[model samples]
Target: MKILITGGAGFVGQALRRALGNAHTLTILDTAPAPADLGPSTRWIEASILDEAALREAFAGQQAVFHLAAALGVRACQEREDIVEQVNVGGMRAVIAAAVATPSVEHLLFTSSSEIYGDGEPGQIFREQDEPAPRSAYARSKIASEELMAAAAASPEGARLSYTVFRLFNAYGPGQRADFVIPAFCRAALQGEAPVVHGDGLQTRTFTFIDDIAAAMVSALDARAPAKAAGSLEVFNLVSEETLTIASLAQLVCLSAGERPRVLHRDHEDPAVGRSKRFEVTRRVADNRKARAALGFRPTTPLSEGVRRTLDSVRAGSGAAEARG
Candidate 1:
């Protein structure tokens, strides 16, 4: 398929490029110019998603669009609300508009977040039927974007566009930014420095591997349209069934680093403060039944194995950095 992926230079984008390189013609659009290492089959365009003309140009002749570009990172979004709103919401508007305008585009996948679930009860797993109670500014922005995409899909103009929304959980693996929990812990542990654990480290999360996420995305893109056709919009939760506490994750990182490092419990307040203590994702386990029934989606990697692979990649990258220095 001829595919256009926005934010195609980011971590997940890089993985997608590596995974789909040989099979598909790929074009990447980002605010920054294309990196020097982009593959020969891939074309890069320098433009933000907010630019309607640029987005239109990028959408031309593409059979599918993967709208992965967004202002991400909880901490970063907490600090820059205005920029997050503009890039996350405004940019999505432009992308959806361009995709609907282009007659050749068959499928458009918008990457949403599990944070839209906000603070659920500790034992309850979030499902598609559950109401969204967004807490943070970032979550609110994502919720807004999802609504926009749904609205666009329902419109008469969007009849030809197939829409799939993925509510991604905590995705971790190599090439992820160091600001996130896993990478941050890995870097600190490797340096023999105490890793910081915020908020008593009791928060539990389902960390989805990057490879699984990419696989799910590909499946969602290729799924057949439903027969009833209320515009054929589907939402899937992309995640692993395993839920690990932050404290346990920290210890695992220490073990991976081959060192028992100190964990400093910082008093940093959660952005979703006073909202809820524990999120009960009882159904936190992704009911891949919907996805599997529709698009042969299955998560193959175990959590421990994925973590080991991530640690290995981090160590290798660290070694490279040391050699360069």
Candidate 2:
């Protein structure tokens, strides 16, 4: 299959590149310049997803499109909702429009975030059917994008565009950005600084490895798209069963670095901290049974192993750009 991944220069996109390997012809559309190690079968297009002409040109001759380009991170989204709206929401509109106009594009897969299922009750595992309670602007943008995708598929113009929405949980791995929890903890641990915890530190999240996320996403290509009442669409929670508190993850990262755990608790809402008060997801976990049965999605990396590898990558001077993706 000929595939096009928007924001393919990022960490998760690079993992998807590895997973796809030479099996498919891959084209990347991103604002970032092409990486030094571009694959033999991959082509890089340094363009923004919000550019309709660029999207139309990129969508040409592609069988599948992975929509991954967006303004990521809770803090970033909270700080600049304007840019987030432009990239996440407006960019999605461009992608959808381009895909609809393209004849060769059969499938459109979007990388939605698990943050949409905000503030779940204790032990509340989220399903695709669960109602979304988005907290931050980022989460709201994702929800809006998902709705747009669904609407496009259900529309008469988008009859040929079958779509999949992969609501990915906390993704952490070797090349991830330090802004995320795992890499941040590892970096702090290596630097002999206290692991910083936002909010009460008791907030829980299920971390999925980058490799596992890529695998699940690729598996969706071969899986059957069951008919839905709404449209020719499928939604899966690409997550692992491993769940932990923010405080525990910090401790784990510190211990993995062979140091005693020292945690620094910070107010997520403090203006001095430069974080959004809307970072309100107290507990976020997902039910991956649908993905397991439908896409054979099984996350193998344990949190300990993942943290160790992330630490190693950080110590080896892995750049932040890769992680930010």
Candidate 3:
């Protein structure tokens, strides 16, 4: 199958390319330059999702399109609401306009985030059926994009679109930006610095490894995959079980990196910067029963193992970065 991965040079995009690149004809679309070390067989198209002409050309003769392009994180969206909305929400509108109309596009997998769940009900395993209560601009943008996909589902080309939305939980692994928790903690641990914690370190989240997320996406792309056509528009929560606290998580990263745990807790919630406003989800956990029953999605990587691999990657990356510097 011929696949086009938007944001193909991103952390998740690179991991997806590695997971599915060998088996399929892979084309990467992004504004950033293609990674220098990408495989020779991989095709790279440097362009933005907002480019209608480029979308028209890229969507032609594509079997599957992984729509992963978006503003990076909650903090980023908070800092640049206007630009992030255009990129996160508006980009979806543009992609749907271009992709759904393309006859060759059978399946378009969109990467949504669990942020849409917001500060969910007090004690509920966030299920697909639960009402979405978006808390921040980032979370709201995610829901907005999902609604756009829903709109496309009712459009004239709905049948041809075959859109799939995977609402991801906290995804982390190597190549992830250092701003994220795992990498940040890893860098701090490696440097023997006390990593700064955003809150009181009580908030919980389900962190899925990049490889597992890529594997799930690969499975979802398969036409005969068990997860296909569960509904006209399908949404799955891609995550692992929540098994650690932010404080524990910092310690775990230190342990993974073979360092002493000396985490510094702080409240980086600055209203002026909109950091607290954007990251409103105090605790995030999901129920994967729907995914398991339909997609046969079973996450295999344990936290300890995932952290070890991430630490290894962080170490390598920091070393390479230092060498370059």
What is the C-alpha local distance difference test score of each model?
0.79, 0.87, 0.81
Model 3 bad stretches (over 4 Å)? 223-231, 270-274
Per-residue error for 236 in candidate 1, Å, reads: 0.4
Tell me which residue pairs clash in candidate 2.
176-323, 177-323
Task: Answer with 1 or 3, whichever has the higher TM-score.
Answer: 3
Model 3, span 109-163: residue lDDT tens: 8999888888755566788878988767788888999898888877766654667
Native-to-model Cα distance after best TM-score fit, residue 228 in candidate 3, in Å = 6.2
lDDT of 1 by residue, 147-246 (tens): 9988987899986777888888888898898778788888888888777776677777888889988887876655643233336678888877788778
RMSD values, in order shown: 3.3, 3.2, 2.4
**Candidate with the greatest lDDT versus the true structure:** 2
Clashes of each: 12, 2, 0
lDDT of 1 at 31: 83
lDDT of 1 at 114: 87
lDDT of predicted model 2? 0.87
At residue 80, give the lDDT of candidate 3: 92
